[model samples]
Target: MENSLEFAQQLDRTDPLQSFRKRFYIPERNGKPLIYFCGNSLGLQPQTARLALDQELVIWQQHGVEGWFEGENPWLSIHQRCKKPLAQIAGANPSEVCPMNNLTVNLHLLLTSFYQPTPNRSRILTIGGDFPSDQYALESHIRNRGLNPDETLLEVFPRPNEHTWRTEDILTAIEQHQNSLALVLMSGLHYYTGQVFDMAAIAQKAHEIGVPVGFDLAHAVGNVPLKLHDWGVDFAFWCSYKYLNSGPGGVSGVFIHEKHHGSNLPRLAGWWGYDEARRFEMTKGFVPMPGADGWQLSTPPVLAMAVHEAALAITAEAGMEELRRKSELLTGFLADGLQETATVEIITPPNTAERGCQLSLRIKTGGKTVFNHLTGQGIIGDWREPDCIRLAPVPLYNTFEEVWRVGQAFADFTS
Candidate 1:
C-alpha cells in the first residue's frame, strides 16, 4: 500500500461500502464534511431518522391512544419488531434479545437475576478501568446486598506499563478466585485502548469454574461481530448511541441465552415483562414472557425505537460481515499511515481480530495541543484524559480519504 493521496482515492473508489457514507449526516465546515473519526463516541445521525420519527408522530396525532393497534407499525409490539434485528446484531435468537431500558439499567436488571451470591461465592470478577458507570453500578449492587465493594468486587488491571489486559492473566485471575467468584462481567472491547477481549474464551473459563459470564458491549456491538448465543454467555447489554447510530441517549438492548429463557431465574419483573398474551388480564401472579422479553420493564419509547429501527435497518442491509471486513481494512490503513507519522504510539492491538474500528494513540508530547490542532482543522476524533486520542474509521460512514486526511493532520502536527 503506497502512502499517497492516489492510493487513498483508489481504495475509496474500490470500496463496496462507500455509498453507505451518504446515508449519514456528517458534520460540515465550509460546505465540506469534517473528517469524522469518532463513531466510537456518538455516531452521526442517519438520513432516514427524521422520516422514521415523523411517521411515529403522525401515528400519534391521528390515532391517539388507538395508535397502539391502529398504525402500519403498531405501538403495542413496536419493541417486539426490533427484536429480530437486534438479535441479528447480537448473534442471538430473536427470542433471546430485547430493546428496552438504558445500558446500566439493563445491567442492573440482568445482575438481579444472574448475580445471585451465597456466603462463599459472593464476589464479582471484572476488569479494571472499565467504563466508570459499570464500576459505579457494580459497587452499588454489592452495597445493596450488604456487601463491601472492596471485598466483593474483584478487578483485574493490565500489567505494569501495559495498556490492555492479557488473555492469560484474565484466565488466571478467574481460576485463582473461582471459589469466591459468583459472576464474571467484562467489556467485549476496552473503551480506552480499543482492545477486543477474548469473550468466548473467558466465557468458557468462567463456566468451567461454575460462574456465569456477561459482557458490557457498549463499545463492541455494531462495531464488531458478536455471537452471544453460541458463546454460551449468560447475559449481555449495550448502548445504541455510539456505533449503532441511534441518536444521543438512544434506547439500549439486552441478550439472554435461550437456555435461560423459560427457566425459573428470578428477575426484577415489571408489567411489560409479563406475558404479552395475558398482560391485559391483570393477573395477580407474575408470568414472565419467555426469553429476554421477560426482562423488559416499562413501555418502549416509540420515538427512540423509531430511530433505532431505522439505524438497525441500515446495519442489516450492510451486513456485519461486510462491515467488519471494511472496518479491518479502514483501521489498518489508518494504522499504517499513522505509523509513518511521528510523536504518537499506536496502543491498540495490531492483530485485526483483537480490535474493532477504534485506534488509541498515545501522544508522546503536547497531546492536547495536537488534538486541538486536529479539531480546529475539522478532524473529529475524541481526546481521552491524560494523553490518548481515540479515532475510529467507521466503515458504514467513513471513507479512506478521510482516514488519509487524519493521517496527514497527524503528520503536520508532529512535523
Candidate 2:
C-alpha cells in the first residue's frame, strides 16, 4: 500500500460518495467540526429528519383521528411501509420483517415465540462477549421459562489471552453440546471487537443440531450485507440507530424466516399482532398476521416510523451493495492507516469479511490517556471498559477525510 497518510488523502479526494459528508451535523471543536467515527453506537441524525417528522406533525394537527387512515404516511400502514425497505436491508421477504419496539423489547418478543425450550434441550448458546442488553435479554428469557439462566445459558468466550473468538472454537462448542442447545443466539457483528461472525455457517451447523438460530444485528444490519432467509436463520433482530442512520432509540425490526409463516405457536400477542384484516374487529380470539408482524404487541408508532422511513429512504437510494462497497474502502482506509503506526493496535479482525465498518483499538498503554486525548479534541469514538475503543466510518454520511483525520489523531497520540 502507499504511505498511509497520502493514501487517506487520495481516497478522500477520489471517493465517489464523498459529497454525503455535508448532509450531517458534525460537531465543531473550535470552529471546525470534528470527525465522527462512532456510528456503531448511535448514528448521526439525517438532515432530512426534520422535514419528514414535520410533515407527520402537520397531518396529525390537521386531521386528528383521520390521520390514521390519511396523510403522506398513513398511521395504520406506516409500519408496513417500512417493512419493504427494511426487508431489503435484511435480505428477507417483506412478510418476514416488521419494525416496532426498541431492540431489547423486540428481542423479548421474538424469544417469547421462537425460544421453545424442551426438557432435554433447554439451553441457549450465545457469544461470551455480547452487548450487555443481549446478555440481559437471554437471562430474562431463560428465567422466564422457569429455568435458571446460569444452568441453561452457555456463553462461549475466546481462548485465554485472545482478543476475539474464533469460528472454529464456536463451532466446536456447538458440536459438543448439540443435544442440549435449543437456540444459538449471536450478534451478526460483535459490538466491542467488530468481528462479523460467520452467520451462515453457524446457522447451518445449529440447524443440523435441530437448534434454532437468531442474531442481534444492531451493528451489522446496515454495516454488512445480511441474508437471514438464505442463511436459514430462524429469526433475527436489529436496532436502526446504528449503521442504518436512524436516530437514537429509533424503531427496531425483527425477521422470521418465511418457513414460520403459519406455525401455530403461542406468541405474546396484542391487537396489532393480530391479523390486520380482523385487527379492528375486537374479535373473540387473537388471530396472528403471518411472519414477523405477528410479534408486534401494540399499535405502530407513526412518529418513529416516519424517522425510520426518512433514514431508510436514503439507504434505499444508496443501495446496500453500494454502501458496502464504500464501507469496505472507508474502513479499509482507516485500518490500513492505523496499522502502519506503531502506537495503536487494532483489536478487530484484519479480514474484511470478518468485520464491518467498525474498528476496535487497544492502545499500547491501555486506552486511558489516548481516550481522553481524542475526546478532548472533540472526536467522538467511545471507550469500552478496560482498554478497548471503537470507531466506525459510516459510509452514508462519514467522509474519507474524516477517517484520515482520525488516523492522524491516533498517530499523534501514540507518537
lDDT of each: 0.93, 0.85
Stretch of 10 with least lDDT, candidate 2: 1-10
Tens digits of per-residue lDDT for model 2, 42-74? 888888888889999999899999998875667
Scored by lDDT, model 2 comes in at: 0.85
Cα shift from native, residue 120, model 2 (Å): 1.1
TM-score of each: 0.99, 0.96
Per-residue error (Å), model 2, residue 259: 0.3
lDDT of 1 at 410: 86
Least accurate 10 contiguous residues by lDDT in model 1: 260-269
> Which lDDT tens digits does candidate 1 get at residues 44-98?
9999999999999999999999999885779998998888788888899999999
